[model samples]
Target: MAKKVIPLTNTQVKQAKAQDKEYILSDGDGLQLKIKTTGSKTWVFKYSKPFTKKRSNIGFGVYPEVSLAQAREKRKNARELLAQDIDPKTYKDEQQLKQQEIHSNTLQVVAENWFSIKQSSISPNYAKDIWRSMELHIFPSLGKYPVASLTAPVVIAVLKKVAKEGNLETVRRLAQRLNEVMTFAVNTGLIHANSLSGIRAAFEKPAVKHMATIKPEELPELMQTLNASNLQIVTRALIEWQLHTMTRSNESAKAEWSEIDLDKKLWIIPAERMKMKREHVIPLTKQMISILSVLSSFKRPYCPYLFPSNRDPKKHINTETVNKVLRRIGYHNRLVAHGFRALASTTLNEQEFNPDVIEAALAHVDKNTVRKAYNRAEYLKHRTELMTWWSEHIEECAKGSLSVTASVVNAKFG
Candidate 1:
């Protein structure tokens, strides 16, 4: 015989009072309103596990917050799950876990985690630049979105917006960084896969704009202008040192006396200070030594840098120091400090120096990894000869006798 069941009415539920002991009021179909001795009422659903046939109770919520009608509806939903062989409690638990994951695995959260791991492998200044770029470009738009929810199209659209502002290079860099962050997210199990992998293909590739520089024939004129300018002594020496060594502006500016080995006749820049993250050994020429001697006379006791900032002796000169000097000396838009590398490359290539040795001297990363390893080991002697020749060429230009280097290069290569 089937037991008859009566459903709870709103009036009865509202008026029900808690006794000395806790008791329950049936709402039919496994729904019950339980009243505790403390007067707190709650809704509960009693059901049997689909596989084990074990009875279990799931809390719908506290009563008044969940009325009789709502409790009945929850019971009806649970019954449907039982019909489909799904446990209502397991389903609820899975949904709660998914919600927790969504709240915790946001794009910004995952990206920050990834950056923390990435910071150890790169220079502090470079790491700051990367984080600042993300703050400016990425975090504003999609930071709150869960990494699992991010799609390639969504990220590509954001990049395309950056591209529209004529910052194609910024867009390109942002794409690479964003991809790295997303890959980190995948590696850390935040997302199933890297959905943002193809986002870079959405934007136009940035144009390659070489640094502005002067032609080889104009070297003598530039040297003449540099010498005639009433520039500060230290600044002039810094420029000459950078040109002679063919090092980047910051690398030259940040040079320490300890890095210069008089016996070895080499300026050994540590890996941390180099652009390629490898130690660079520049063979010091007699002209390079002469410039160092001038700097030695001007060196402040408190400053470790060859080109200390005028405002702060503890820090090296700003990277823009050479550019500003060039602009002030009437070379605006035509030359920059970094342009010195291009100048050296052009002159050396024209003189028929081996391209591999020239690239090695410039400390450029070779595209062929195997060849790069071989060249680094094999090209030091050749690099020294080439750098010595370049310094002599710079000296001839400074003397306003550019043709002297031509005869030397011809005799050497011949």
Candidate 2:
């Protein structure tokens, strides 16, 4: 025989008072309102595990907060689970864990995790730039969303906004990073696929603008203007050294005293510093040696960098310092610091220097892996000769007497 069961009503639950001992008011089908001696009222669903027949109580919530109607609805759902042989408490726990997983696998959280794993492999400067890009573009909009919730349309909207702002290059880079983060999420099982994998073609392509450079005939005027500028002697020498060696602005700016060999007339840049991640040997010409000698005379005794910063002798000059100098000389977009490489490559090739030697001097990696491995020091002698001729040619260009007839160039280098 079973005790008579009456469904709970809001009026009865509200008027119920706690007694000396805790007691339960049953509403049938395992739903009960528990009144504690402390005057607390809670709604609980009592049930038995299907396999073991072990009794378990699952709290729906506190009464008054979870009204009679809401408590009854919760109990009905729990009964459905029990009928299917599922423990309601276990089901609740599994649901909570799923919610926790969704929160943990958010786009921003997973992107940061991926960045931590990748930062160790890249340069500190490069890593800083990568983080800056994300902070400026990606995190604010999509950070809180779970990686699985990010769709192709959602990502395209973000990138399209950046492209519309005329920062197409930033858009391109952000697209690449967004793809990388989403791909990381997929690889880590946070999502099923990378939604941004094919999103690049949807944005506008940025126009290409090559670095501005002077024509060969204009080198004399440009050199004279640089010499006559009110720039400091050290800065002037740094510019001259760059022109003579044809090194990138950062390579010239970050140069160290130890990398130079005056005796051998060489500058050996380490693998860590070289853009190609391999050591490069520059054959220093007489003019380059002269510029280095002048710089050495001004070197601070405690500074290890060849071109120490003016404000802080312990640190190298700002990587933009040389470019700023170029801009200061009224050549802002007309010529840039990196333009010297183009100037050299163009003039040297025009003078019939061997293209392979010129490319090797530029420290460009050979595309073919087998050739790259064998040709790391290829055409060393020819490059040395080319540098000497280039130095002499620069002097002639400065003197306004450089004659470049095809026959003259062919006979001289051939």
Candidate 3:
């Protein structure tokens, strides 16, 4: 009941031994104020709430920091709060929780906010890819760890886990990218550290395992087999399109009929879908036009897709369909769908075309300034010529000509 109020005058407080000068003040019925050696006093409320039923001591404030009159007022307030069935100790803990929440909503939270804000600026495909890597790999591991707590060892652990898989190259690349994300967070003053730079040198890298492309001479037979295979019509058309237009698999896999202008004899790959992040226009050869012509015999129009699936007929060709077919035809490990472009590049170079012209045909940037300055034609003429020769070459292999094999082309390119 705390009815006793022991107050010490300044002289008595000074006279008492340092250890003996404890002054206790009783605030009404339930609150007690205790004065310490340094002349500071605080209000303590001793009580028990529900559940555990253990006694709790809550400090209101220091003496003078909470003056006598203020202390009495607080005691009355505390008693009123207690009467209302609220535990003062629990109420104070709830307040501390709120204050902690406010501080936590700072730079680290702001970094995530910025990432979301900048997401729309990038292509949706890239955004999804990056977000996936962050969510699956980065966030699960460190999302709740404060950005300030981020360090080299922590970041290295995330990458080493990926490196343990056979994809050493991708692990290396993602490690570099993650560091960039962390550096970006730091530039915003969220992490105050660029952990990427510190850990970049520490990650052990594996030697590159280059996948060999089909020899050029060998490509003619391969192409002939692909063209004649009883594969799905969409699959056949896509293969012919790759050979004729020399476009990437993903670019052609997601091709919309609208991206192709039969009358204009062109295929315009949007910047978002292109790995180089630039609009690429491919000059369609007569062979390519024929392939598209066969594909358009389906139900979908110029709006949805040129190569919509047969089963659903509402969706574009699954990106993996080409690789799946390659495996089906026994080129699983030796030749991939992407190998078609590499084979075409080598063949085109062997056919005595200019290097820049061939690169332009592949929609690659020319390194020479002089060549690039006036090289806007994008090899439409040469690409057309190359496609005609390429199609005929594939036909020669279908006829089983001994002179045309992948081995011969391999020697030429090699």
Candidate 4:
């Protein structure tokens, strides 16, 4: 044990240097001498705890920082905390309580606010998709987990389960949504960083797939088979646009007439309505342009959507309508409308286009931050050529199917 001393100085240092475990300082009354240890010289009140006057260490930091003069002042503050029965070491929690009392957002309550802020920036369909993923995959198990605890391991485990369940597409989409949500949390000062920041290292992505597109050779038969079925023309056309434009099914279904500029030969999907959150400019092939011109009479050019629902003219087409049509055409279990996007990606790659060009045409988000940080260019030239070829392939298949149907009908009549 050492006697504690106040205001270390040249004279005091000389005297204290001779021995360890020796500290000297006067008590608050300035009458009693204080004693401390060299190894751990924690300050303690010989009296009761701060709020109750029960004796305990009244932490006043270490020796030099809390001089004899300062330590006594802290002792008085400890007495103040004592009057309220609050522990001195628990001061940090008190400050946090104060922060909360002032209405600062915490990890526990920011998700819904984050959702509301983002909904308008995303397509209503995408907003719906995000909610579904959150509700099913995350909300039940993790909705209450502090956002701060959503480390890469936790997120990876969730996504890996989805991938293992043969829902690889959903695994990727969920990862994307998680990344966006945490990013919002960061921008709003809720958490310091995105929880999915190192997600790539935490989980291996499922095998990259070329779209399981029906082959051009197989497509003619499939098309003929589909054409003769009882499918709504709008639903059929919705699926038709998906193939011709190589666009995502939801994108085609939710198309707004106002987004198309026939004179410019472009269809500009606003960033807020797109998954990538960047406006995409797609060149329209002559065939696609012609299809729009014909449908334009039935769809007012200034209406809410190019494919507005017949049942609700002001609303965009239903997200599931095209898929229902596919299921009815007997491709339900075998092929999904979403699979069509992959199909185009796969088929076009086999035709020898560069990989990046094919990806951009499909509106895949850039996973490479370095590329996004530096490159400002998009794959316009390749997408133009890509879309043109895609339209030709679809139209050719539809014609083959029409020919087959005509032949069948003629035989039936005879």
Candidate 5:
């Protein structure tokens, strides 16, 4: 037969006094009040743990601090847990540990973790910009908050404020970067889902603006200005190399001699140096080879780069070197170093060259993963012919002649 329990009253609990030794007074079920010799009273709940059938006692706090009614409520809730075969003490401990984890893993902490992994796959400059954006826009406001507590509304409000300031572009980047961090959190098990995925829709998209560049017909005049300009030999060579190869500013600036294969007439940029994180092969043309030859004359013997920095022989020239040179030569706002790629793309497409080959030469990867894999080496042959034609066309544009012999083109543009 089950033993019957008589619940205690408020008056009896209030008037109860501690004896010489500690003793307990039962309320009902698993609830009891233990009064110590020091007059301290604590509410204890005794129960047989589920599965193990082992007896355990858990405290609901002290007497006046946890009033009889409050203790009774806790007892009721605990009984429900026990009825479902969940040990109340283990449940409480697990909940406490989760709360501690939430408090410890702040957004900034997790972002730092995600960035450490992300930086290896991107350029150093880009990595700096990402961290700087977070520091300026995000970390100041919400960095200290736990990632788990980062609800969509709270994050959207932050982005909306940035949007209202006419920094729509910044807001766009912030949204993208924040989404990455949140998605990283999800993947790392710090959070369950990325609730902030839709935050980008809360702001207006920035207007598309192509890089500024002169018309293809103006290449001769620009080349004339470049030739007349009193620029350093290495800087001019850097600009010409980038222009001829149709490579990005940083990619050209950071070029290493080892990446060039003179025998095969190929410059193979490793996956790490490329923007899309894929290896790019540029068919070195006659003009590109000439630029390399010019750079080779003054190249430091110990330097691995074709265009080493003037101030630091160990490092390559600044990525902005060509842009500054362009501005100095009166092409400010008229042309940028990046404008070289656009100029090349426009000229090739206009010349009726294969668009896919041109895109491949430009190092633009196909969006389709499977097709991209198949096409990586597919366009090399077509690209070789296309590069030769483009180099010849550039020679014609420079010489202002209809036909250019190999020797004459090499002598003039090379």
Candidate 6:
């Protein structure tokens, strides 16, 4: 016959005194209060391994820290695990490992790790901006959560809060960053799936605000203002180069003398420096060459940039320098440095210039893969003609001889 068991009570447990050696007071169903000679008491669950039938004792916790009722609950849970053929101690170890993993794989920890890998491939300024955005916007609410526990609803809620502040652009960028980090976690086996995938649909689409630009007819007045303004000579030159080339502000500001070929009448912007990750060739007009000639005369010794910073010759001019010039000349909000590209595209397209040639001049990526592969420079001849006409047209505008009827049809090119 099996031995009868008796349950323990709080009063009996409190009255029970420690002996010279360790001893156990049974509370029935494998729950026991263990008393040590050092006057300490612990709650332990005595169970048998399901397959091996080996006895094991797993500590619930020290007594009083773990009340009798709490210890009974833990003992019941461990008994359930043993009945399911899982060793209680092994289950406890597994739970501990899972908790450790949760601690280590938090959203901020994983995001920072992912950022560390990504920072090497992107520009320093761009990387810093990405990290700054996350720190200000994302980390506060979600950083401490385990990445595995993050769900779409939780992420969307956080983003909506950011959107509520009228920072829709930041919301979009942060959503993209979140998706990237989640995808990284998925790829690295830290997550089962990317919870942020397709979450952008939940956000309101931010209104597109094209950079401010002036009408084509406004160019003559703008050019006259630029010419008559008493801004620094270098700033004035930077503005002229931006309008003449229609390059991105940063591209023009960071121009290197080595990229220009006065003999070839071309500027070959390398792939690394270009936004499209493809090399671009700009066919220089005589006016463009003259501007470069003047810039070359002022070039500092051992400096490589065409527009070196006034304070630091080793660095290029600030990317915002030309925009600031426009603002100082009272064109703020009415026009910006990037407006030149839109101005050129609009004017040339309206005049029925070959769209392909204009697009090539802008260095825009062609959507057709085969055409992009074969015809990256296909419209060079036409683009050369277009650039020459464009420069002369700019000169006519500056001289106030240009009318709305002015077109490239009358210009000569080879």
Pick the TM-score winner: 5
List runs of model 3 lying over 4 Å from the truth: 1-111, 114-126, 164-167, 191-193, 366-379, 386-388, 395-414
Superposition TM-score, candidate 2 onto the true structure: 0.75
Q: Best by lDDT, which number?
A: 5
Q: How do the predictions measure up, each by TM-score?
A: 0.80, 0.75, 0.66, 0.58, 0.89, 0.82
Across residues 1-414, which tens digit of lDDT does each residue of candidate 6 receive?
A: 978787888898888788989999999888999999988999988888898898878999997899889999998888888778988898889989988987789999999999999887776778899999999988999999899999889989999998999989899899999999999999988888987888899988899999999999998899778766676556766777888887998789989999998888898888777776677888998877867766765687778899888998889999999888889999999999999999998888888987877887888854243255345455566778888888888888877322211111122201
Tell me the deviation in Å of residue 4 in model 1.
8.5
- RMSD in Å for model 1: 6.2
Which TM-score value belongs to model 3?
A: 0.66
Stretches of candidate 5 above 4 Å error? Answer: 1-4, 15-19, 366-378, 400-414
* Residue 17 lDDT in candidate 4: 33
lDDT of each: 0.84, 0.81, 0.66, 0.65, 0.85, 0.83
- lDDT string for model 3 (1-414, tens) is 834655534454334332457766554455676767775666776666545667776777865576656656766776677777787777778979765654574433644675686575676766777667667766677667655556678777877787677666666666666665666776765555665576657656778665546898676567666645666556766766665667777888788876877787778888778776678777776556656656656645533887787667788787778778888877878887777778878887888867776776676873243255444454455556666686666656556332222322433422
Off by over 4 Å in 6: 1-17, 27-31, 37-40, 47-55, 63-87, 151-161, 196-203, 366-377, 400-414
Q: Local error of candidate 1 at 407, Å?
A: 25
Clashes of each: 0, 0, 8, 21, 0, 0
Model 5 over residues 1-414: C-alpha lDDT tens digits? 977878899998888897999999999898999999988989999999999999999999998999999999999999999999999999999999999999888999999999999999888889999999999989998999999999889998888888888999999899999999999999989899998999888777898778989899998888778766777668877877888889999899999999999999999998889899888888999888977777776567688887899999888999999999999889999999999999999998998986767787788864243345446355566777888888877777667432123333445543
lDDT agreement of model 4 with the native? 0.65
Ranking by lDDT: 5, 1, 6, 2, 3, 4
TM-score, prediction 6: 0.82
Compose the digit string of candidate 4's lDDT tens values, residues 1-414: 865544434344224332355554445432222344444333444445454555544345654555655666776776677668777657846866855633445333566777888787767766788888888987776676667667787667777777778886677777777777788878876678776876755445667765334644667766777777776455655666776776766678778878898887889887766777777778898767755754564576446676778887777788888677777777756677777776777778888876776777777855243245334344455567778887777767678335322333444522
**Off by more than 4 A, model 2:** 1-53, 57-88, 351-357, 366-379, 400-414
lDDT tens digits, residue span 1-414, model 2: 888898877788999998999999988888999999988999988889889999889999997899988998998999899899988899999999987998778888998999998787777888899999888888888888888788889988887788888999898888889888988988888878787798889887778889999898888887777655777666776777777788888789899999998887899998788776778888988777766766766587789898888899899888888789989988888899889889999999999977777777787753243244335355556778988888777777656322222112333422
After TM-score superposition, the amount by which residue 352's alpha carbon in candidate 2 deviates from its true location, in angstroms, is 5.2
